[model samples]
Target: MLLPLLVALLPLSAHAAERQVVLIAHPQVTNAALTRDTTRAIFAMRQRSWPDGQAVRVFVLPNNHPVHARFAKERLTVYPHQLQLAWDRMVFSGTGQAPSQVGSQIEMLERVATTPGALGYLEREYLDDRVQVITME
Candidate 1:
């Protein structure tokens, strides 16, 4: 019974390990790393500037996107619905704005790469030289 259970779980574990989500930023952004709290604040749109005082332009996938959900839960330690609620509240209250939403991961990569001081997240498989991976400290 134990052996069968282990075998049954192996593929799920392997698939989980394979889908690594990472924070990515434009190369022009000076910061190389950020604390998870700061990252969360940025994604939440509560924090608007990088530590160096450069204006931060945040990009994101739609709330229903799988990568967006995973990144919100795994990296930011928040649920996608919670993030959406926060954004909606901000918009309705007129106190802040939501991040720009891209239709796909490829668009995310393109926007982050081309926009100065842009920050976003992507799966490991989608990474390339166009954007720099920001280490989450």
Candidate 2:
């Protein structure tokens, strides 16, 4: 009885769970020296591209986006609200602004894939052979 119901709902749940925005770089990207702090710096536009020689562009999900929440916590090492405070703090301190935000995972994926020198995040589920996944190493 319940088994059939659970089986029926599994696909929907799997679909819903497919929203992880993996950071990515170009296929020609050769350097793997980026750490979370460095990645944050680059994504925030605080730092530029790799020393190995590639143009740099940064991207992000929208301000209130749930995809951004994971990035804010895990990579940026701050909460969304806290990150907002950090940006404000930086602004007053004569520092930099945050990365420009895209509206959705699909948009982010498309932008980064099509734009040269671009870097961005989109749900891992949305990833294909189009972009090269950038890992923090």
Candidate 3:
């Protein structure tokens, strides 16, 4: 029984180890780092500026995207469904605007890399020179 259980869990562990999500921003963004709480607020669409006070332009992949789901849960400690609900509530209630949505991670990377003060996240494998990684404190 123990051997069978170990075998069953091996693939799950391997898959988990294969993914690494990271916060990224336009190269021009002035803030060097952010605390986890600030990152959560920014991605949650609650905060509107960097610590330096530059306007924050947030981009996001479609809610159903795998990378989006992982980034929300792992980096922001929020569920994708919960994020959708929050965004919906904000939009419908006139409290806030939804983050600009991209159809794919490639597009998200492009948008953030080119847009001033932009912010978003991507899996490690998709990263390139166009954007800078925002280290979480």
Query: Best-fitting candidate, measured by TM-score?
Result: 1
For candidate 3, lDDT tens digit of each residue in 27-76?
A: 99988799989998898888989988899999999888999999998888
Cα lDDT tens digits, model 2, 6-93, are 9999999887667555788655667544688877767656676676667677777766887788877776676777666656776678
- Candidate 1 — which residues are off by over 4 angstroms? 1-18
lDDT values of the candidates?
0.94, 0.74, 0.89
Worst 10 residues of 3 by lDDT: 13-22
Per-prediction TM-score, please?
Answer: 0.87, 0.72, 0.85
Q: How many backbone collisions does model 2 have?
A: 3
Judged by lDDT, which candidate is best? 1
- Clashes within 3 Å, all models in order: 0, 3, 0
What range of 10 consecutive residues in model 2 has the weakest lDDT sum?
Answer: 25-34
